[model samples]
Target: MYVLGLGGSNHGFSACLLKDGHLESMIADERITRKKYGVGLGMRLAQGFSRNYCLDMEGICLEEVDKIVGNDLLVPTMYFRLQDKIQLINHHLAHAYSAYYPSGMDECAIIVMDGVGSKRKAGEEYEYESMTLYYAKNGKFDVIKKQYGYNLPGTDYVENSLGIFYAMITDIIGFGEHEEGKTMGLAPYGDKEFYEKIRKYIRYDNHANIEFNSSDIQEMLQLKEDVQAIKNQEEKERICQKIAWAGQQILEEIYVDIARYLQEETQCKNLCIAGGVALNSVANYKIHKKGFYDNIFITPASGDDGTAIGAAYYGYYH
Candidate 1:
């Protein structure tokens, strides 16, 4: 059977074709459009992607494809082009499937974390979660837990997002939006004392779910304001680097703690991690070194762009 998968969100937009359980062709919209992060996909781009990649995969006809799958968050938008062919896959389930299947493990614990997933109507503080955990065994999947971050209605900022916190720090350091890697690289040069101050702001529940208080957000903004007013370039760089270090420290600690919790709960030695945050090598390495899992697998395409792979796997198996 030939299956076509599609994914689209604020971070990346992509598509993939799978034939009889093997990848036939996969293409991210950013590669074709030359736009970084590949944020949006209108009907035109969706149709073009399908016609060029999905329909032509190894001479497979679009009509011959058995199923068309889409990320749960993107399927409604995709309905115009795919019509009845499209089926929805949950956001976190897609991420877990993407990581677990690609890891080549028969069983594993999966963690998916990103900025946001699903849509929110007004007055819904937790319309979507920022992170989730799942256990997969022999092609079966079960949700262990999912954590939410809160945001007020009509506000651009989420009060409890590590992704947003990192992105805000990236901007505070004068890096353009989506340039989180620059901050990660600069983190090692930062002062240890500053990192301590930043790490204290993060608190979590017994399930390893994270939340940030209003005071923490205000303090972060104040720090940004302070850094912005610095007169010396060296001083600014020093402070920004410190902030980056602190951010990385918080991220790493939270990831390790969550992984530890999962290991304790599941007793599974194999772990699969996905989402944009999984791209942070520092945290990934720390999680590996913590000895919670005998083997750690992170998908090559850990970001939102790779959700197409997960959507396809969901369609094929589920």
Candidate 2:
């Protein structure tokens, strides 16, 4: 069977064609359209797919595949309709499964953390929160195994996301999106004091499921119109470093704790991780050093785009 995976955020989309469990061809909508995220390029591409291909390897027609998977051709929208032949995988779950399946590990604890996933209702919090845990064992996926999520009450979940937190600090430091890596690089130069202060904003239970208080740093800072008046360029750099460090620190602590907890609970030595946060190389390095698991695997395309692949895999395998 041929399995296809697609992933990305608002700025772009990526698609991977997998046949017999190996990646065959992968393309991004942005590349084809020359648009950063391929915002409106999907329909054009779907039209192209229809004209170009015949007898899609999966016993489905190109028109049918396009109809079902091409509905949400725009970036960041998950409304794609791929003729219902391809199973839809939850964006994050795809990240989780992608990591696990490729790792060749039988039993393992998986953690997928990202800015957001297709939104799920959480009581008064209509917006989605991060899902930090998903465990795979005996060839099945379980989301309830032990998970950590965070959302600020009465606010859009993205508003308080760690991904957004990092992105904002990156911009505040004058780096913009391209400079996010610079912020990450500067993190080692800072102290942990900022992390201590930010910790007050995060609330989580014994399981490490998180919730941010309304008075979190982002909200508190927004209250002051001229936040820059007090925080100059140097201060902003410090803040950026602090934000990077804190985000890294929290993820490491939580992931390690969760790994240990899951390891103990499931007695599994293999671990896999996906999602945007899994892209945190610093945390990945730390997790590697902590030696919580005999092996760890993280998806290379650890974002929403991978959901397309996950959806395909889930459809074919499950």
Candidate 3:
């Protein structure tokens, strides 16, 4: 079977062609065009494809793929016309399956917490819309559960994403988003004062859903902004440390609560975690050390890029 997996992402558009469960060809849009993320190249390539020349998947072909995937799917502009032969896995499910399938675990708990995914509403123009999760066992995959938290009204589920929350704080503290690992390293230098402040913003319920009060975060941001008035470098570093500590603490608490609840509900010792949040290696280490599960497996490409693999795996296995 020839299965083609495609991913639309802000970082870059990617396509993978799988032949009978093995990756045949994988390429990113940037490599061929010499552009960073293949921005605005989708339509350009689509026009190019009309000429009937064999174009490499990297250059303008991204735009062709995007068109095939649909503009509404948040695919990058470069992937407008490429066809995806395999079953398309929703962004979250792609993350979940990529984490679970490779582990070779028969029965394991799966958690996929990402910034955002496709949103649908029941009884609307479409029959149904939902954020879905799947469970695989004995070579069978089934929709075990779904989450609707992202659809809650009046929430900045995309831009001010929880994943970006950690990333933004990392940037404000003089670290790059790619350098978030530094914030994890610095966590040992801080105390729990900021952690106490962050507790006021998030509340965990019996269902393991984390309720975030926006006003609390706004208030804290205001306080931190004021602290930036401090002229001394040492004082500035101290303020950044406090903010980082708060973010780290909140992530730990929320994940622990979810992990505990999933363990109780599923009674599974092995846990597979994915999504942009999974990139927080420190939080990951904490989850492991806390013994939330006897074993933890994280997808190496835990971000949206892994969705390509997830979609292909779901297509083949299902």
Q: Give the count of colliding residue pairs in each prediction.
A: 0, 16, 17
TM-score for each of the candidates: 0.90, 0.76, 0.75
lDDT for predicted candidate 1 compared with the true structure:
0.78
Candidate with top lDDT is: 1
lDDT of 2: 0.57
Sequence-dependent TM-score of model 1: 0.90
lDDT of 1 at 82: 69
Q: Write the per-residue lDDT of candidate 2 for residues 1-318, one digit (tens) a residue.
A: 655555555544666555566654555555555765455554454443311222343445444432122112224243344445433445666667667776788788887776666566567545554555767887787765423244555443354355555555455445655345676777787668667755665555555455544456455346223435555676755665666676556656765665566666666778888777666787778878888788888877665555555544554465
C-alpha positional error of residue 14 in candidate 1 after TM-score superposition, expressed in Å: 0.8
Judging by TM-score against the true structure, name the best candidate.
1
Clashes of 1: 0
Model 3 scores a TM of 0.75
Across 115-161, the per-residue lDDT of candidate 1 in tens digits comes to: 77654454734556678888889999888887665664454446566
Candidate 1: worst-modelled 10 consecutive residues by lDDT: 42-51
